[model samples]
Target: MAERTRQNNGNGKHVWRGIVIAILAVIVLAAFISSRKGEVPVRVDHVTKQDLITTISTNGKVEPMENFEAHAPAPTTVRKIYVREGQRVRQGELLMQLDDADARAQAARALAQTKAAEADQHAIQSGGTQEEVLNTRSELVKAQAERDSAQKNYDAVQKLAQTGAAAPAEVREAASRLTAAQAQLKVLQDKQQDRYSRPEVNRVEAQVEQARASYTAAQDLLKHSEIRAPFEGTVYSIPIKQGEYVQQGELLIQLANLRRVQVRAFVDEPELGKLAVNQPVTVSWDALPGKIWRGEISQMPYTITTYGTRNVGQVLCAVDNEDSRLLPNINVTVNVSIANKKDVVTIAREALHEDENGRYVYVIRNGHLERQTVEAGIANNTRIEIMNGVQPGEVIALNSMNAGTPLRPGLEVRAR
Candidate 1:
């Protein structure tokens, strides 16, 4: 029994010793793995020389450069509509006509009055017209004859009354007749006294001038009845129909010269300051894909205003639209090239960092990260130009995480 017990005890000791050896090996392996995990694994890409661009993108709308809108000049019926929407017209081409019957009658009446006033003015300036002066003289002669006859009868009646051959009533009647004739003669003499007076001539001339102005105004109104195109353009809109009555100043026709198009970009206030005249602009339409229109900033915003939820400024850009595919008032997207650099070494924008010192990036060299202060040139949304402090063919770390901390100088990194 003692011999059996001794053998069992020896076997137990060997088993415990083997177990301790396995535990110690496991501890050492775990420690080595933990140390390896301290280094951050990062993705890296090498900088290369390529064209770099910086742009500000915003929404915009199209407008016509040369546009015309015609309106009704007065209350009248549209007698004829000669053009429809989307019709091309030349300068002086007739687009519509209004009912001119009333206008023509007005012109005729004004012309007759003007002629009569002119004749009266001429007569006053030259001692009256020949016919008027002759009639006046004849009227004077008739008045004189009547007055003499009345006076002779009154004298006869007075003589007869004195000799008791006529009644008293007869004598009074004769005296009244003579008085009436004398008054009539005096009125005629006064009328002929100032036939060519200055005031009379001036008054006649003033009447003629007033009538002439009315005649001219009526003629102009008559001309307005025929609506003609003021310039060469395309008729884009016509709002009235034939035989429709329209009030004064109502919109009638809209014409536009679409050879050139203008884009009004509503840029946010933060981006407004970056805009300048002659900056290159690219436009794209949602309705059409894979198409682009180019232009330059023709005008800058003079002030800021609110558009929708954004405080924006309007920037006007002019573009060539010879094919006329870009219509007015169409909404579009615009990209303004604020800066550009070509054939330069560039890095991912995610790799850039800034501090009080300056802008910088992390360069991967010898399996470690080196902090580099770089002068950046042009930057787009994804990438940026490295003007200095970094060279082409050098790898840069995209991101580094050290136990929830950012990367810094001398940080070991494993490239992925």
Candidate 2:
């Protein structure tokens, strides 16, 4: 009986072991089948030909194309202001005036002095005044009379001597008297000549010139007391009131030509490399609501700088402001179209990936994932331009949620 029991136990053990091995074989086979049969659920997209416009957005500042700032010319009181803020004015229009009583008085004094100096110069250049000329003429007449009388006496004495009526010694004395009278007449005429030395005239003329220069300077200072518009524009600021005392170089007024405006864009340093000259730009301001301003990049910064809390590079653009709606120093949104493409194959940026071989994407076809290497061009925040390696209308796998978990070659996928 013991031998029979032992044989039965061995049989039972072999039977149980065989059953367990068979069950384990079945489990392994089921696991393999499930692994091969399962599909990865993924987000997918169809590559399409579309226009892609790549842009970089940033904040910008609005400024006038031409700005003018006026300052006080002297430490004086403001007498009058002709134009108010927001008033349009023509070039050279009188804008304001300071108390010019002192300047005007100084100008009058300078004018009087200039005239006096000019008169003195003229008298010296002309040798003498009218009265002195008349006196010289009288002296010339008297000397001429004396010379004529003495000559007549000498002639008469010579005639008498020839006729034997006057002694020879008396004739000689008469001739000597005539000679002395002629010499005296010549000396008187020389003293009374109209010509004066050049040095004396030039000295007086220098005084006249100095006085004239002073008069000109005084006139200029008086004119400067009244401010004038430097160009045709609108006055936007006035810091001084009438009858207010102001110092020299104080702020007086601010003006600008609002026909056109400029925008200064502060771009992040990372995006600065994408900026270029003449790129199309769009600007909008919160204050103006629905209005859009159009422009193009006119200037770009050569180096990076700091703006507020960010390191940025500056870019300048010009906007048309014919209606003068956009004001100076206003904040606005700036969009720069850095790159663009016409009709081209594109995919969402999320569908693209990069590896050592460069950029790539997974194409889903026939329930399998196909790895594709591609050349990419311009890309914006949401879309990427596929330059090559992927055809239009190909399905691209974006995401997967399964055991395999990611896009892989020959992996089974089902797009949702």
Maximum-lDDT candidate: 1
In angstroms, the error of model 1 at 173 is 29
lDDT (CA) per prediction: 0.89, 0.87
Clashing pairs in 1: none
lDDT string for model 1 (81-123, tens) is: 9998878899999999998888899899999999999989777
Over the full model, what C-alpha lDDT does candidate 2 score relative to the true structure?
0.87
Best by TM-score: 1
Clashes of 1: 0
Worst 10 residues of 1 by lDDT: 399-408
Model 2 CA deviation exceeding 4 Å by range: 1-49, 55-61, 89-94, 143-199, 228-231, 264-279, 285-291, 297-316, 330-334, 364-369, 391-416
Q: Could you estimate the TM-score for every candidate? A: 0.69, 0.68
Question: Residue by residue across 297-390, what tens digits does model 2's lDDT show?
Answer: 9999988888889999889999887777777888899989988889988999999999887889999879999999999999888889999989
